[model samples]
Target: MPESWNYLMDMDGVLVHEEHPIPGASEFVAELTGNDIKFLVLTNNSIYTPRDLRARLARTGLDMPETAIWTSALATAKFLDSQRPNGSAFVIGEAGLTTALHEIGYVLTDRDPDYVVLGETRTYSFTAITKAIRLVEEGAKFIATNPDATGPSREGSLPATGAVAALIARATGREPYFVGKPNPLMMRSALRALGTHSANTLMIGDRMDTDIRAGLEAGLQTILVLSGISADSTAEMYPFRPTRVINSIADLVGNSAAPF
Candidate 1:
């Protein structure tokens, strides 16, 4: 609740709703930028790079710089690079995941890779899943960008990386190491990127299951905003609770004088 706390915020719910900018979201971002507060917009979606996400947010009237964005793809890539530098992977994902791995000098191949990496994709291919299963069965490590079972879409919720990872796990009897939200590793990576300590960092998220859990696990203060997936009533069901709850990010807009 301190005024000097750095922020780590979720993208979809805390900043914008779907493709639209949440009310007062831009002002909140502007306040942070103007004050030179270190912050990062976090997302479990591994489909787009930070640059792509920045442009998308720009269209929603929020001018978030690429440096302020962090996706699961980047976190996963960093994890892999640290765990096994220049390792090979059989990737089942899109440009974001692939590009991150490539940037870290990972070889994307099906020829006995060190890991079979799974990430969110618009169209998950059965052929690819079959190949992934085979690779895992043959002793390749399994890794997933996130544990989200479903992803938001215009039509409705679509099966996400976790669901697909479940399928592959069932087939090969190997569980995937999920590297995104709900995992403290992602928060640690984001914190390192922000160059901030957890004690003075605030994590604003909408979901108790992933964002809040991750923040708490990473030793950061968490705030649950009601503008996203979870409601106040739902908070009681969770054994763990966020440090604070707010109606929306709009409430925090120029009111940094008050403890958030």
Candidate 2:
């Protein structure tokens, strides 16, 4: 890797696990900050806004500015803004999603919406899902933040955006357009936000299906870290491969002497 390379890193598995910072994850971030390397923390979870996420990471000892954090909500909002400016939608999500849409001048309504936007939330509402189904059946476009079937929690895996989207799809017979990872649109949007070229960027992620695949499709070199969801044997299961594999972010800390 070159000295001028920028970084795009997954949030949950790469830097922290649930509510705690992964080993050396803080150091890696510090190294990047101290060295003035350009990077952004990416997450498919649209439950919290960037400000909320920044505070959450701070609690885990990861010192990142709000500007350094990017969420699926932001990407979705940007996509919507470009596709249909000032459009209305029946949104099923929390602050992150709603705030993003609001920032883009999108109206949130259940009446004759132009789209049905689905995002991650701790408590999925039956009433909202039903309304979403009705809206989609009535000709609203279906859109989802990501294709993740499950999200991690202290107790266990919880049904995420993808699962809920599947339910809506089943009822309405319409597959949603996912705006997050593996679509390349999310990665491209992040790259444009960071103002960096894909050739000079490194995408560090924990999932082969989402982060690595998205990075690869977006034309960036990818590194698979085994600190989160993927294990050692997991990479081989995928047809595509990462540029390199490492135990965790610890290996990359103070790696000035070696290729990143």
Candidate 3:
């Protein structure tokens, strides 16, 4: 049976939790694959490319194809590609981000750029921050993968790419043009890839603030899996709630029944 959803799911909490597989996530994803459901791992973490994400998932026992995943790194690259013919970008991010952007033919230059892209900077140096801000204030377009305040790791969570982006935004008196979840651009690109719109789609995520909000804003039904960031207790504070909430993806019995 064709599900009401042509799905787009988040990878971090919904599938793998900080370098490990969340129990039952594989079952949930298997259900979709068994049913011939079209889905993509739409994640805002630019720390890893699609291939890297797949590799990580494979280590944790879920072997998803690279084509079935999409990362903010790739989206940011594609976004800049459209914005500038031969755009030069100033990237204050990790190696994964710069690598993805470069693959798409962006000139990653610090001296002159048409855009300033920000992500989780492993080396969040004062020099790097200052240079990014100067470039933005000097008329370069400011873009960020997502506005996450912290990065999720097995050690817990740390100040995220959004924190880095915030400093530059503060310095320039301009907000970043966000490209990841909670922003419509990510969903727009996912829809284009799926060749379907919201009505036939469902979004599965872990964070209500970012993942759920992004799907809701993009007009897709939302599912929250509590294996990652947004725990059940934390969900109560949200202004809006997910369409369904499940303990794990494996708890899902069938397409007709819901766990909420």
Q: How far is candidate 3 from the true structure (C-alpha RMSD, Å)?
A: 2.4
Give the clash total for candidate 1.
0
Off by over 4 Å in 3: 1-4, 154-156, 253-260
The residue-by-residue lDDT of candidate 2 on 15-94, one tens digit each, is 98878899999998998899888899999999999999999999989998999998999999999999999999999999
RMSD to truth, every model: 1.0, 1.2, 2.4
State TM-scores per candidate. Answer: 0.98, 0.97, 0.90
- Quantify all predictions' global Cα lDDT against the true fold: 0.93, 0.93, 0.80
Whole-structure CA lDDT of model 2: 0.93
List model 3 lDDT by residue over 149-182, tens digit each.
8875567768888887777777889899988878
Q: For residues 106-180, what per-residue lDDT tens digits would candidate 1 score against the true structure?
A: 999999999999999989999999999999999999999999999988999999999999999998888999999
Badly placed stretches (over 4 Å) of model 1 are 1-3
Residue 232, model 3: Cα distance from true site in angstroms: 3.8
